[model samples]
Target chain A: MRKKPIPGLSLLLAVLLVAEGCAPRIPGLERTSTTEAAAVRADDEDTWLKAHYRDGRVAIFDSWQVLQRTVEGDGVLLGADRDTLAVGPFVVPLDSFVLFETDRLTPGRSAPGLAVMTVVIGVVGFLCALNPKACFGSCPTFYAGGDGDEHLVAEGFSSSVTPTLEATDLDALWRVRPVDGVVVLQMKNEALETHAIRHADLLAVPRGPGERVLADGAGAFRAVSGLNPPAAGIAAEGDIAELLRAPDAKERTSLADSFDLATREVIDLRFDAPATGDLGLVVRSRQSLMSTYLFYHALSLLGAEAGSCLALLERGGMGGAQSLLQPSEALGFIEVQLPDGAGGWRTVGEVGETGPLALNVHLLPLPAGCDASRVRLRLTKGHWRLDWVALATLGEAREAVRLPPSAALRDGFDDPETLDTLRDPDHVLAALPGDAVSLVYELPPGDGDWELFLEARGWYLEWMRQEWLGSPDLAAASRLLGDPAGSLRRLAPAYKSVESGMEEIFWGSRYVRAAR
Target chain B: MSARRASIAAAAAALVLGGCAGAPGPRGYLSTAPEVVHTARGGWVKVVRSSADATFGSQLVVEGELLAAGADTLHVLTGTGPLTVVRAPRDRVTLVGLHNRAGERALASLGLSILSLSNGWYSVITMPLNWLVGIVESHTQSRVGVLEIRDGPWDACRTHARFPQGMPPGLDPQRLTLHWYWPSAPRGFSTPR
Candidate 1:
């Protein structure tokens, strides 16, 4: 039996052959025969040259390579040694001699050639589709959530989500979610732990009654002259003024004029607490100078309780001097001073170490039937630097003080349409009292990929003063007003970790169609 | 051969021929006996010479005015104010011009198109055949121009080499290619021919 010829193959072959046959010719010069050359020479110079040679006729040579130059001097027929051809400085040996040329019809653009190039491009595209790994290496995977929201677990480029609640269930509620803020939950089981709950969790707790400030150490307080005068009068804006001195021998003594804290050195501050109801005091304190290795200091709150003198002493140590310190290590203890009825001070109830100054709140509960009036924080056991103190009825104040708005915390996207309406920057700012402020936002979902971008702005007051003490440049004037550059660099990152913690929160995912 | 084999053979041959047609030839060469060499009285010309090891040898061609020509040597004024002397033997050194015919170019282009279609369905059968033929018959020839000597005395040659009117004085004229009737020439001497 005879084998059959493939008709499709034959058709394709014929088509290619015809296409090649119809290809456009490239324009170039052609050599004329001797007779034709004679005829050309007989004609007028212009006509003959135009008809026979191209306008751009110049000699080009190929030695080991092609070297081209124009004909200048008239021919003088020299030595015919088959070894080399010397034209001015150039020497062309006969052995390597290839060829020389004038104008030649080089290939011009061809329609057929273009079609072939297109086919080549198509083939490349097909090959690329075959090896998908080359086209889409390690494409990101996304999981759709139960709410129909896409969640990207891993493998996608995106900005990080600030976790509101990572683990555990909290029944308490907050007006505004703290960026790097935490909530202390005193469980019914007598267990106390800090929790980073979501805004939803904070809403679960019932709102408390209105609150009023009973006593604020940052308020107007008269300083006594018997001991070393500690710097008073709002040293750090929004914070109570207290002595801040480096650990120097001359400054450590009670008699020294610049004593930061000394034994028996007392500061008389007057505050009106609730007369007859259950009341609590919140004390905000940090080490005078933020130092890494510092001696342990004890603070005693002395106040009149039911017509008697009372003193509550609390001792604590400062942790790492670095910019980022834990709340427990950075904050001092809060003491509730009550009267012992024999003209002596007695401790009624006391709260453990508070959070960092301007970060966490320290609460102290007053005794029943106590007449809240004058209070003093004296250096009892060790040295201490005080920030401020405030009193409120226990469980009465539900919300913290509303703080001023700061531009650093504002989101870049100011458009109300895309803004996360649930976030309130003012509420979070009011909770912490200090010269420095931190603003955090829960980035909206589906704003493309998330990337870590931190921008901080603030200036250091000490550095500014030093500049002023030196030559007094314009920068000093700006620093006096407020320089955010220094503070931004120091605080933004610390606060981000505080707010986000270490847990990863995935937001949305996207689906992309595979290439055919 | 069987019918199927014959058909396959014909297709293979077509592919081979179609692929080899567009190969280009050598760029240029020098000639000893040129048939027609036409140079205007004061025209610009370039000469190229071939050397051994075609890739390594240096072949330099001079471009300048026809200053002076003798029986064994020709002195030409260069563009940079230097005079270059070239030794020429009768019917020994000539400038070759090159050109490609239209027909040959068309064929070559067609061949290229076919070879580029190597990814097509029929390419499985035609690719090897086209490659083989392409290797054998790729190059296309270029036309060559023969340099002819002008019959004139050395003094007359110098007179012919004078810078045209309005040409800047002391400006090297050899760098320019002299053409007939250059539009940018001085008003009176527009047609150098």
Candidate 2:
């Protein structure tokens, strides 16, 4: 009877065989954290395995070899001291691959691994069996007939010979190679881990396809998947052929404007805080344009934390109510005893709505408001990106309103809506503290000798991490952030300290030893 | 059911039960094995809920030391004795050394001084022999009181006469302590409500 080929049976059989050939899951090998877990497997017999942990540590045990099964739900019983050791249930984290080695089998002694000679012959014969059309033109036995064909002819060979042809020379065609009990497994931080026992003296050789990991082999090996995954794919990189492209002037301008704005915003929040008075009024009125820009940006980042103009005016420390009265506004004045004796009162300026948040500051000549001189600015637009700062006579009380702790802590992560709400300066200022305490939550001593104080309603005070008896210059600060030789250099001066709810940047300390 | 059917059913049930077996257990990594142990003791884990309650308060105070004198400015550290130092036009002459704290007795060794002569040129002097000498002599329409030493005779520092009682105009550090009394326990940090 002529053989009739079955349509889908082969495909179904192939899938079943592949599925059955996979390893089984191992148990108790999972990674457990505050958030996640993992497991591993073996595939010969239907059993479970458990990793042993004692006294909060993973137990290291003597190794015993057992045959690994290549069928689902099968577990191998690894005996220890004439008794069954812990059984593990292995489940590979989905979308992960495990590379492993199998034992080599030999003639007469049925070793667990596949025989090299047998594999060679099996591969050649399989190709021939699958493609009968290639051999149909010739007889079963062959004598040198096709051009210079060697050896006994196919016509003379027996029909049961199976006609083997080993392609040993084609190393490129081979995917699996012999390995000696070694394997490397890689899993992501976001995924599960797998388990595989390691022998004392086994070493692995590289073979197979996707992302192979070779082991150094010493103990029972288990590779738990990491919680994070490897990047899915690589992005394209490399120089491309030049192609002429030009945009319209209008479009270009728009793009340029957008880019400029972005850069400005970034610089504003990152480098500067905000000012309390008009941009030109603070810092001895001697601030540069760049500093002014930075100051405004910092103000934007502060959101509502920045105070109103009127509040700035009322600050007696600036000069007193008299200095703020537009040189004509009548003021209530009083002078008490000063430490040095014989002090006077004078108002500088005041600007704002009459409410508590209003800003009014009295300005003295150069050094009167020195402590509160520099105006710091933060990014009030597009999330909490602190980019710029300016030093003005008035400090950052008005500009720091953008990134107040309460609102910053509540903004949604990675959301654009949160970014949108942070852009408006008025809203930013509103978030700022009306008084001093809100601006300064905590102040800790620095490096033993340096003392840090929060300048009430002052930008420098707000960002003060630790101030040494002697202040370090701006260049020294830059060195601290840029130097790689020391950890202090690499240490970020600014961070929201969890213990104290304050956004702080470290200012230089006094060199006590130098002073001594 | 037939015996064969029962055997098959038994295998199916075993498979189901086995699938659910070995649910993940607590982990032991790093030095401390998180609070998972307390949570895992209960079989068939249950999700716990969280809650929070708020209590309001009056006011808060921040304390720190004042450093050095600035140009046209005088900083007073007021945590100790003789907290108030009255400045007079005669440079260093302290008008009235109100030592009422030490049973109305003033420290004879304590004296006041003026270092610089600025825009408001007026003769500056110090009275070493007596405490109330400068208060009776210095003639100035306005006086700048710098609260210097904070610790001392409490009675003298807290004396109502030393302060005009209505000076700074806004919040009286001596009287109007709003005393904010809010609970600091963060929201959603407690057991289920």
Candidate 3:
């Protein structure tokens, strides 16, 4: 349909360009009287100006006419002998000076114009040709509107695949920074799934400067300090101490065992044991696309009957089917252990966080009496990607205040139902496909800094895929549900064939990056 | 490079863009397929084959029967003489589309839509508006589909390759075909039982 372009769109674009092109200018570059300019002599010291003289010679001055009636500047001759007449510092009487000026530059208006135009055009193009808002999402994908754009901080209850399986998932809103004591956390159901959200709130804890509120594996939040990076980290691939030394995105991920998706890989870490108080092993990591593969493949196996199957699970008709953890049961958590002096190892605790959109920070605080000389992490070979690992001096354990949405907006209009559903335990905010609800919360006033953890409680049912209907592998689904380990091994060859493209099809959806 | 060059480039761009999208061709007619099947070769890629720099390596929606997709390169069978295989950089190939019946029904649907004026002058807006809406909605839905891998590790699309395991492998791609190197693959999804 070749409809004529709307004049309103052009006007909107023009306004955007104008807004972008308008940048704040440096003060005092205005037109001023000679007396006023003379008064600001100190300011002129930084301003470079070209002085034209009555004589054929030219001079550039930093301190224009500093002395009574003359100025000292680099003497430049513009005649044929200009190159030969060495340029040097010389003084010229103000009487001989013809002009006093500084080169003026108009900021590149086109650059801003092009940028605004590109953004405007890109947005229009996306709206017309792409559905960025309908991309990959599971559970309640939270967006704390920070840094001008919506920054994805946490995804709540990502592991909960159905209503009966719903669990409370905690995620540190590390990237979120409250503005004027307010944080607007946007909850969006961007995937083709029905998300039943019961509680959407923030856990706020006070912390001092240079201190972070980290979650311990035992579900305790603590303001930890003295972050000590591991001295050495030895993985199956090789040494990865350098990668684990910082919370940089440069991660260490290993290849999956072609046969068993649950194959464990160990990374032995050596940390300089702190002399005094208790410590916690902090691990920064995110899940690999393996879970996404299992989930999607399970859906495919369920095939055309997936919708009905999921509906059945929702109604509690499928017995304990809603408790389906599948491949994750074999590979979900990361085990942390300490080397027993007698060459044996003692299990300390396990750190588990789901979703691949953002990296999670998990602190496995060792028991007070346990030794922390050496630590070994046992996790599924390719299931987890580590960004950083450190031992922190555990400070005071703090409780977070849950702040629910002060106001809620679904898409754009005020949604009282979402607010009610989130607050009332009996009712659930069942978000359907393409639903974007912004939850605005005002951080409680008080303190130097606050650490926020997103407390999202919900479960979602993935919509049936039309493509999967072509070949319904119900037997595969049953095996996946019944015997995960064997099924994962048998399905390895097929999964490997299409593994590389799975992330693109799963998490790389425009919906994940959709504007709030 | 220069003012004159920029203006000429802009003019050429407008001229080329002007030729794309109209009442009947590849625009406002098609809706999302009720069902779509992956044809191997990088999920049925539909690249805009172009030679101009202004296009940034995109132009017309060329023949979308992707032959073989690797990590770096994409081989698409252009429907030219002898069905020449047009090789493009995987990164440069932006569009990926499924070969739905949109091509077959597009002309007929469009022709009938033109006569949809029997509904009165209101047909002017409704006919094209509905068609364009369908196009937009379809593309958006396709974005999250399994085969819509515009941002790719391209290796998986190779599953759809004529030689799924690439041209060389010990019977790669899990598909059995022979050609000295390997046997020819069967036309449709023939997953080894």
Candidate 4:
């Protein structure tokens, strides 16, 4: 088929459409799209926008058409009829513009009403950009209304872990060590008391802050962190008997001035009024009991009624001494006795208390090489107070470390053996051999007469008590008679008694034995 | 008034117009093939002999024999020298040809192709916008007789029909299979079985 072209009418219509600004109909939508139309409008607005965007710079605007805004370096550019606006980096919509301005197309003269609206919009835009609520039409994301910029801030010293000092027993020696930042005091029990140095409550010297003081009343003390010696001195001021002596030189030095002479190892001496005029004590010899030697002496208290008392004193030794006893040694043996020829003896007067009697004893000097730093005294008779005023010098061979006599006399009335023996009618002290002492007393044939005899070696001390002196044969018979009960009753008028003397020695050693 | 004068005038006008209207001959149009090529090293197809009667607008339907042992590949004879390979979708074989846009549209709109049926093979109706006559020469057995792209209800001018119903011989509809290939693939397209 041949088609004829009728171009005149179509060409005329196309020209009319182009001139009228009616675009060609696109395939889909007949009307012009707003996107395409926006491009057309941009042509005129681009000059205003170009100054802001030529190098990809940006000017923030409050409204679609106003130019008022804070300008930044790069942003998206939007154009409307007669104006162009630059929106900053955000993606806010055109309707939400808060602060904007009108950039006048004519440089000098701004559009009067539009320019005012632009400035108004510009203020709003800047506020809205800075403050989201103005632009976003909602409260700022979280908390917004604070003045400028401020916030809340958190607010307490940790407690200390100090340790308390406890009182300790001070009877023994102690040593101190600081190990691993802790101070430890060790005792003989071989246990260590560790104190954390940092955690302990620090005790400082009065003036020195570095020095630490710890007083555990147990005689333990320490100084930490500095060189400060502990205060050392004896706390008590009285004399104490050292029974178990320390071998240490330091302990000896401590005891030297602290103990009295009687408390050191030495023999004791005492003196009393002699019972007869011109009486004297004699030392016959010195002998050894073990390794130690002692001086011996025979002592006599003289009086017309003293023979009976002196015999009792010999009986107090359980037997008289073998040799003359030293007066210093004989001081402890004070008793009176009456003897029977049958080798029995009886105590008559107050032998330990105030008897005129005498006996023998030996004085033992402190042994050679013996550490006589401690001494303990014990008495078997009366309140034996001995006062020593003599100061002696030590010898190369042997030295008598003399001590004041501690006088004690015990009355042995409570002793059942002695008491029963005294009460028995048939009991008799049998005759001893020629060499042994006869500890015996015989009663007289008649009443009220008694005698006691004490024999040892070749020495004899005999006491005869006679109330039958007017009858010659009766008096001679009384010389060989002894009844312990009758003799005690017969001599009860005497001031010193044997029973009281033994009680003193028995009670005096109670403390000494316990401590030993 | 004279025959010689009229011929001479006509000759002169032709000469003048030839110089003015001699637009440059259309440069040979090079295009990416619609069906991507997948070729083994030696596989090729060429126009061994072309009809002198064929003109520029003449339609061509060339289906090279593909005896693929393991996989199928295509070779398009470029007419320059060698054959160019193309890829085809799995389960569907491709035929490369040339046709006008109106012809392709007519086939797409009407669901028929005289050329495809002339050889007794089914030819696919491609997009009307495509100028190439390349067709998917396979029919999906599952979705048969259904018009995939149809004209609006009752508009005969916008013909509506199923793709690839009628075809020429040697390409059976049962033997041929339509397989969807991802469009962007440069090689034979295949979907997981």
Candidate 5:
């Protein structure tokens, strides 16, 4: 948890690389001459011999033997008058040759790149200074080999920042079409944080034709058939026609009010109540990273005590709810409200979970005998990106078959016991920045439709940046971690200072983009 | 692992992989004068000639279009001496090599390598590695014939000669460009075991 602060180490290294690349490429300047005895002693089949004559003639031999007075070898006589003339089996007197030499390594291609870089670098100069303050964001990034090249499938437990806040996160491995009986999930820690993954289990349920298995707010899987879009959906801006019509990334969001991030906004949708089975309000949405920024800023406020402060949360140092997770909790869920059919709107249930990187789909099951014709969704302004909102007809709850990872590998080295560790709640597969583990899961071979949900239980620790140091706010830290609504109101302007750049900075973590 | 250890490993990987980028791949060569007949894929030849001094600075070089090579003899044509023939003898010949150019690529690589310095501490390792890759890629590659550099009664060299069938029936050496088999030139690349 404790890291030493290094100053100017980054700048020094950048300058050093520029210098190495900037060095002059003088032709044959790298060639170092050796004595005849040194060349003979080090000579072998792999050795190449160079004969320098007093008459200014030079030749290279592929193989040679030194006689009492004559050097007899087979190789080429480099003649300027023609192609390097090949010669051999003939004896050249030691007296005729001024020096005999050999080189172990070829001066690989003299990089023309160095010369070009030197000029370009000389002109551009140092553009980025070595800033030790790094942008912070991390989670176990999972790639199902489906999310385009750059897009990640899911980031595990994006909200779980500490041991106390560690919770089992469920993510639908969206867009994955499993081939054969295998599903390989590449779990990567692409940030400056340590991930302690307790377990990664593939929870799957049979999905019949035209039927989708979705989890409710309480993590209960429901078979929802005929998910119909709202007859009409309207938000603060206008009709939510193109945006919230489907689970596309095309989302509907309102800007944060100038004064408060907690300002509330609602979208009303009219749906034709399915007179048959139980109904559920299906909402697929994700947080806006505003909460993530607040969390990091709060940690920065803690400064030197960041580690100790987190340890306190883990050890119950700051009592009550988790201070780090409080802002997210204050923003609350996407609360669904349906008309009582008596002029007032009554609460139905809530949908959505935390995580700004991936979309969360939840079935907020409507209470029996309730009118599902009209619904209103209430949420904090700019706090969420709603991708889809629909009314689904729910069926019976189905039991799931858990498929645990059969093997875990990193760089081709197998660690099969990682399977057992993933099962045990007490153990964790720890991953540092740049570390990656492939979790291989084998399912029963079948053509039947099955939806896979990743149940990743873990937590992570963000490595503090130097920019976070020197500022310590104890009372404010407590208020932020425990009471977000109150502190959010006071910290509004401060949050605004970084609101515009936070998302870009958080996503563009230096460690995350490291060469894979 | 500590961030320091992870960073160290990353740097090490960068160096090893970077060195590999410019590593002599299958010794590919591009001929600038493709129209001319050449024994090797590339006909350009550089002969490093060293005096008794043997110092790098004391060395001079003769570079020209390769003509032909026979057993213990090399013939080259030079444009600098007003389209003359050069007959370089084995005794005066030093190191001989055929070369290629990767100047443009090397320069571009250097530019990008310098730009990567913005990556903070990572630049220290990446910068030099980038430059190395560029240079390695821009190598003066060795060809098959050059790789097997030994006494040549080479069929290709003989065929590429102005007098492939050993001097013509009525052609005179003085009338045609004088065949300079052994000229005042240079040496070979040396290696330790």
Candidate 6:
């Protein structure tokens, strides 16, 4: 007797067929040897380990070696130890290292657990789909503050404010409030504490201007727009003044017909210096196009000049030996000098290799113990046109400003205008002290389902230590704060009935709102 | 079950199985099978023409169909004309049959469309997933094949001679030559079963 066909058999068959179809197939005629396959598998294994394991965390083991004998460290496993296992600074040969033991954080081993959790969640989701209301009540929808006078105080409040002011000191407490559709900080200080500072006033803090001197023909040095070429065998000292008087021309020859100098020919530029601050010279130069074009086309052009040009190009055009001479190679350097108190010119720095068709600022540092009052610039090598020279005061030596361990609490403040001002790094540096500052999003009353999210923006461990919030684990910290629902929870008590949806709902690093 | 209902179910099952079976695996000049070449009588064939001289490199790939199969030479109809026959020496030329799955390509296109429809809005999450799947799928399949030329042009005899209607647009006959080549026959060039 023929048996009755099972229901859904066709569907099952279809699924099986699909699975079989999608199953990876080995090419019929292709021969993948055991060695090749093993090599490929080893490569894949190494790749997986590298991707999942944090640097220096994986343990390396040799053949017949136990886990205890494995070399464990916190650096990344570079690759399979064919010769040596390169884990950062440490390297162990393949004869000694064979196997890899993944760290706790490695996703490969933990993937099975995650997959199981995903399946469990999927099953729960299927059940929920059949009986939605039984699994969860109406999903709470949160809205920002509308037109209302009732202000709900933001929870998890911590402030940098303290009453440590002297009798004459102005102790102030700042808080942002939406006024006339603009978020302005209301400052509470000793004299006029209740006044609200304008958003513009809070935003615009005056920045210290940089110390720079623009030397445009108006300086103490004789500014020459153009100069004539020096006569042959002219003294280096005389040629220096002649070049200084020459116009800022593209080609070295155009400034003065025969500007090319013999070895050690010095073009001295003198300028009066300032009394204080470290002085630096900036030379604005223009590189010629002919030098580059000639350099590249030297081989094609047949002549002694072409040969010399080609040689120069190979030896890094005109200035110094660079890698390659491109069409944009208009670069040259000049030795800077300041009087060495010992009655001689002291070489401070060399500046050049300016960009093509653009003003290149070459900063020349002054020599140690040199007299800035007698600052001078001397061109010793390569032909280049100088536009103008500026004396800039280098930044003074000051203690490095260290950013304090800070945490930016991102509540439901989606106000871009206000948030931009609040989150500005410059504004934070200027306004707040090295203490915690709360950016409270004062919502309208009756909106009970508000979720709070805490973001450890920078230096999380240090911030946690400072706050005495115990471990960096979000769930543990939330539990310590009398929050039973954990870091990922909903504000409403009705939503707290189901913890299965918590992973999906609280996707990122967030604090679950405590049930009221 | 009733006859009509069983027929409907059977039809549905057949349709799905047909879709899966007809799905095109992958397409490339090197990956073409000999069976495909035999069946593609009037269809286009990509021919890699090697030079008789060893010093001068005159290797080129041309798209044509078999015009007349001789004992030693293959008269192929090239882009120039039917009269402009390319006398490809049987020993010097390699012929590969191209088979592109239209249905499988449609399915893949549909799958990509669905993925794009869902993930286009949330690209941050979907983009990575899409890339990962793509990488995995690409590594799993053989997209390109290596053409292995043999001593005799007897392989051309297995392929029938027929005049093709016209060449497909955007098909560059000259540029279709395989990037990789060997002086002699390479492995995995056995006659298709």
Please give the RMSD to the true structure for each candidate, in Å: 31.3, 47.5, 31.7, 57.0, 15.9, 32.9
- The sequence of per-residue lDDT tens digits that candidate 1 reaches over residues B1-193 is 1123334544665555544442221212111122113222222333334454558544545554443344444444334433544543222223223223323433443454354332222232233434443334333322222243433222223222222111223444344432322235333222332
Q: Worst lDDT window (10 residues) for model 5 chain A?
A: A127-136
RMSD in angstroms between candidate 3 and the native structure over all alpha carbons: 31.7
- Kindly indicate the candidate among 4 and 6 with the higher DockQ: 6
Stretches > 4 Å off in candidate 5: A1-137, A146-151, A272-276, A445-447, A503-516, B1-193
List TM-score (chain A only) for every prediction.
0.25, 0.13, 0.69, 0.15, 0.70, 0.25
Per-residue error (Å), model 2, residue A276: 35
- Local accuracy of candidate 5 as per-residue lDDT tens digits, A119-195: 43433233222112222125887776632343456678877788767789888766666778788887878666789
In angstroms, give how far residue A390 of model 5 lies from its true place. Answer: 1.6
Per-residue lDDT of candidate 2, residues B1-193 (tens digit):
1123234533543343333321221111101112211111111111111112224322112111121122222222222211223322222211111111111111111112111111000101111111122122121101112122221222222211111111222323332111111333123222111
Candidate 3 chain A: worst-modelled 10 consecutive residues by lDDT = A24-33
Q: Is candidate 2 or candidate 6 better by DockQ?
A: 6
Global local distance difference test of model 6: 0.30
Lowest lDDT block of 10, candidate 4 chain A: A152-161
All models, DockQ values?
Answer: 0.02, 0.00, 0.01, 0.00, 0.08, 0.01
Candidate 2 TM-score, true structure as reference: 0.13
Per-residue lDDT of model 5, residues B26-50, tens digit only: 1222222111112221133434443
lDDT of 6 by residue, B1-193 (tens): 1123234534553344335434221232222232232122323444555567877555555555444344445545453433223455633444433332223322332343233322211222232333344333332222222233454553343233331212223433332222212333223322211
lDDT of 4 by residue, A282-354 (tens): 1111111100001100111122333343344345432332212222233332222223235543332211111
* Per-model TM-score on C-alpha atoms: 0.22, 0.13, 0.54, 0.12, 0.59, 0.23
Off by over 4 Å in 6: A1-420, A423-516, B1-41, B51-58, B68-71, B83-152, B163-193
Model 2 interface DockQ? 0.00
Off by over 4 Å in 2: A1-459, A462-516, B1-193
* Full-model lDDT for every candidate: 0.28, 0.19, 0.58, 0.21, 0.60, 0.30
Q: What lDDT tens digits, residue by residue, belong to model 2 across residues A322-441? A: 222221111111111112222432223322111000011112122342222222221111112111111232222111111211122121233333223333322211112111011101
**Per-residue lDDT of model 6, residues A351-377, tens digit only:** 654222223334555544445544454
Q: After superposition, how far is residue B165 of candidate 2 from its true place, in Å?
A: 96
lDDT of 4 by residue, B84-110 (tens): 233222122222111112122222212
